[model samples]
Target chain A: MNLRRLIVIGIPFTWLLLFFLVPFAIVIKISLSDPAIAIPPYSPTLELSGGWAGLKAFFSQLDFENFTFLTLDPLYYTAYLSSLKIATISTLLTLGVAFPMAYGMARAPEEWRATLMMLVILPFWTSFLIRVYSWMGILGKEGFLNMILLWLGIIDEPLTILNTNTAVYIGIVYTYLPFMILPIYSTLEKLDLSLIEAAEDLGCTRTSAFWLVTVPLSVPGVVAGCFLVFIPALGEFVIPSLLGGSDTLMIGKVLWEEFFSNRDWPVASAVAVILLAILIIPIILFQRNQQKQLEGDQ
Target chain B: MKKLSWFNLTTLTLGFAFLYIPMIVLIVYSFNGGRLVTVWAGFSTKWYGTLFHNEAFLDAAWVTIRVAVATATLATILGTLAGYVLVRGGRFWGRTLFSGMAYAPLVMPDVILGLSLLLLFKVMFGSMGMTTIILAHTTFAMCYVSVVVSSRLLSFDKSLEEAASDLGATPFDTFMSVTLPIIFPAVLSGWLLAFTLSLDDLVIASFVTGPGATTLPIKIYSAVRLGVSPEINALSTIMIGIVTVGVLTASLINKRKVVQRLKDEKTAN
Candidate 1:
């Protein structure tokens, strides 16, 4: 039995190690190599003397250069901060919209619950890229929104809604809203109604009972939803790239440019390492909280 | 009961409208005759005709289908295995590591994941192309599939497998005959999820795909960068139509099962 268990576990472990872990290790190693101008830095064969010198140079070069450049450089820091700000704002907005929707689903008639849940997830099946692009048609200068507004005499001029920060926020929130809703809905679905009934029987108003009982009970789902939104939003590339204007510089776009346009692999890796570090704490907390919830249920 | 208060009804109607209006507009405008994406110049199927003839778009679509299918299959297999182990196997050396590896891709930012994969390809494989895109997508796609499959595994009955094993069948035979059938639905769902993710992926594909290996999303992105046109709208309309049909079908099937299970419970009681 033990050997069977080991074999079962070992297959996935070996697969992940070979494909996932080793690849990441190679990335870190390549980041430490010198960028060759005439040839690609990643040569199939390592030049013996050049490799030793490159290793030494890599170690010596690993100072505050990349970090300082990322921080002190106005463009870099601005992009990093703006990306965080957008992601944070979008996450909060999604939570605001999704909370009420989830609560409504939870409280709705049992017959309607599944249909409502389907409504919430229906948008998710569509291509994410297509959904993001659809926003352009709705928010562009001559797009549907503007046309409708003009017909209604709401505004004389078309709104400059496309390719802006607002557009980026809208795109991010729209894409991630389902992620926020499902977890919260699952938690709310499993919530014991008797607890609420008890609170009410004790003379707690619906509002007070919701705050004092339901809200506290759904903390795990809230955390899961937030982490789900925040982590991916932080590194979101597609929305910001397609909808965001020049002003909407994000870390993901920066990393893309560094690797593809600038051919700066080392700096991109450094940036990635930093992003990974930023994500570690929240991910660990979210996972721990989720595990505890699972154990509690079990 | 408030008996459907006006405010609640209004919110529900408006929320659905907000979700559906943009999609409707995209669908309607796909038939627009003019090049202008916004203005509906008397309905025509020219854009659909145009879409058919656009070899570039067709090629990208083909590439996307290939990638999605391959990633879905590979991720589903690996994920089913990982899910089985995580839910049913005993804790041992490297179990934690395996779990971490499986879950790590979920939390990692797409940018970081894409960049890391790009660097890996450059260092080890010396090329950025379709294979890299497939590898990067499968990395996270497998994680998602594993999570979904594992949740299903958790609720599964262990005794059925034991019963089968005791009935003079080998473990493999028992798994094939008993376990596989029970988990097949979960595996199918996992595959669908993986397929959608692989198809929707843009950031990772952008970082990994070479010049000739652009996918549909990449093509649409580049076209949008130049300018939005009815052609893109036409493409989106078709894609959204397919997705909507798929989602509605799945939900209908799920609802039927739920109702059947409820009836069974009530009958037992």
Candidate 2:
């Protein structure tokens, strides 16, 4: 490549390498090292000045202690499993809500589709923290939901929804709803109406036609949407912290508490490393779906 | 066109309501005269005034804006360049790794990104605060910007750029005079997205920020952690209003541009 090309590509490449990629190396290194009370918060710093001897010493000191510790602690394992469960259930709920809406948008009159799409995208322009925080008012013990329910005589007392798993589910579904809708809408919009017509002509009922043709075809969008929601919901910090009770055991919350409350940087790093390792399968699958879509478009 | 089905209509209405009700409540209650969040009193703008007078909130707001603007501009530049290189540059060494890096941050969790970036910053600069926050935001925000810009580029009319260069303009001249203008909307949206991402960030900012460099989200987080406050509701209302206005105006501009393009195409034909 020419000088200009080199400079253009080199800048982002170098930046990502420095800021995005290399950081994981540090985390992995820190996770294996012992925690310290000193500056930088971890021990056995690689002494590059002593070159080969320093490298040897650092390598020799590195152990699987942190990873092992993670296994021994039931809290860590429970947090991991709980995060996955929450993410999975929330993804399904988002899909249930979003699919119909997306279908509606896809089937809307041509002029109205843009407006509907804009409405969905508008909430995202606002702060995510604000949106999640907004629910606190409605779900609180003395909040609007309870007041309305009590006034209607639906319940004698308020239902405890805030600071619970249900609240986390609501936050996840609400915040990530757009991610689910947009992808599904795009795929459904491009669906060939003729296929449904053909199916009907071949003796399939309307609902059956939708099931066999429309639903089957929209699977790609559904998968994409699910992964989009599931991946972030798995690692979600703000939602669980704000909405979940103290007993809720999300890995993100656990990691945060480990680093901040306990000041155990190494253990936190190990949690993060393991989290990323688990995410690899889903990430790779998402990447493949995207690649296939691109190729199919071409 | 097929008529809308009742089932579809019902869902669309319910879905939008679910999406909007919490925010509408939040905005409406921001004007509540009472200090208690759930209590409805006479409508008042007192909370907005209170938000303005709060020195800590104002300081954090200013810091947040500075971080956002810088992050947006830097992210746009880097992201635009990266998108251009990826789409047009083509077939470079380690292209797979480059593409993987570009996309990975999008799916990566905020906590991990924040933690790892913090560790990196400590080892490199041993520094924290405004610069660290900006760098951290830019790193992730640029990845998002790249996705937006690259998607725009993917379906771009490359022949226009090719035509400009074919007329003997230099590549840089062709890009500046032709490609940039054509993709300006995408670039603008990318900047806006980056700006908002930085403004909205709480997890990453908390991780990388050091003493005396609290951003608005971090400030809001700390406040809300105590309990919902009227001042925060007023602040959120302002943010929602700004975002709503910005998004509506952008959509209007985009729609108008599309109309004008179609009109021009008709006349040319």
Candidate 3:
């Protein structure tokens, strides 16, 4: 490459290497080191004696004790499995709500589509903490939902919703709805309506045409949306901590408590590393899908 | 008339209601005279008034603004360069890896990203505060900015730059005079995105922040955990109002540009 090209690529490459890639390596290193009562709460891997020999000693001291401890602790296993289950359920719930809205927006009059799109994304622009926080008033015992239900005579007593898995579901689905909607809407908006029309003109009904033509074409968008929601939801700390009951044992919260409350940095690092390893599968899949889409466009 | 079908209308209405009602209640109750967020005795702006005087809230807000501005500007610059390079620098070494790094943070869990970055900072810098927070925010925010700018870059017209170069302008000159101006709007949007993200961040900020570097989100989180307060509702309402105005203005500007372009095409035709 020429000088200009070299400068252009080198900045981001080096920045990401130092900030993103190196940090992940540090996480793995910290995961292997034993927890200490030191300020950082982890044993120093590199006791800088001199140069190369110091590095060799540091490498030699690394152990898999944290990883083994994670397996030995039943709480870790429960947290991981519960997080996975909650993430999966929330992803499905988000998709269910987002799909119809996206479809409606995609099928709206051309003149209104831009405004509709803006409206969908407008909520996302606000503080996510605030958005989740708002649910407190709406889902609490004396909150609006219960008040409305009581007034409507739907229930005799206010059903407890806050600090429950249901609340977490509501929060997750509510917060992530836009992530699901935007991608699917973009794909659906670009869809060849003529294909659906052609199917309709044949013996197929409109619903069948939708299922056969639109659904199949929107799979990439659906996949992208699911991954977007699932990956973050898997390690979500805010929603579950804020909205979930004590029984909602998510790995993200567990990891946070392990580090901050228990002062177990190695265990936290191990949890994060394991989480990253699990998420890598979906990340790679999403990247490959995006690459395919890009090639298709080209 | 191309109107929504009943099913479509129901879907839109319910979905929108679901999205907005909680926010609307929060906003509405922020003005409640009563202390309770749920019970509205009458309209009052007490919470908003109190928010202005709260020293902790004010300090966090100031810190947040500083971090947001710093992160937004730096991220936009770095992200623009990265995006331009990704699009224009053809088949360079480690290009694929660079692209992956740029996009990976989008889906990487905040917990993992925050933990890893915190570990890096503790080992390298040995202290955490405003600088570490800015670095962490910029790291993630730049990825978002790059995504925004690169999408714009994908549709960029290379002919304009080529024509500028053909007229004796250098590559840098062509970029500055021709390419940058054309893509300035995208860069601006990217900056706004980065700023908003920096403002919205809590988990990552919590991990990296030191004693005096608490942000608005972190403060709000701690306060909310104590229990829902009308002050938080008022604060949230103010934030929501600011964001709404910002988004609407941006959308209006973009819409006007689209209309102007369409009118130009019509007149030309």
DockQ values per model: 0.60, 0.86, 0.85
TM-score of 1: 0.93
TM-score of chain B of each: 0.90, 0.96, 0.97
Candidate 2: give the TM-score of chain A.
0.98
Docking level for model 3: high
Which CAPRI category fits model 1? medium
What lDDT tens digits, residue by residue, belong to model 2 across residues B142-165? Answer: 988998888888888889988998
TM-score of every candidate relative to the true structure: 0.93, 0.98, 0.98
Q: Which residue runs of candidate 1 sit more than 4 Å off their true CA positions?
A: A1-7, A42-64, B1-7, B257-269
The CA lDDT of each predicted structure is 0.82, 0.93, 0.92
Which of 2 and 3 is the better model by lDDT? 2
Which wins on lDDT, candidate 1 or candidate 2?
2
Candidate 1 yields a Cα-based lDDT of 0.82
Better of 1 and 3 by lDDT: 3
lDDT (tens digit, per residue) of candidate 1 on A198-280: 99999999899989999998878888999899988998888888888887888888888888788876677767767777778
Q: Which stretches of candidate 3 lie over 4 Å from their true place?
A: none
Best by TM-score: 2
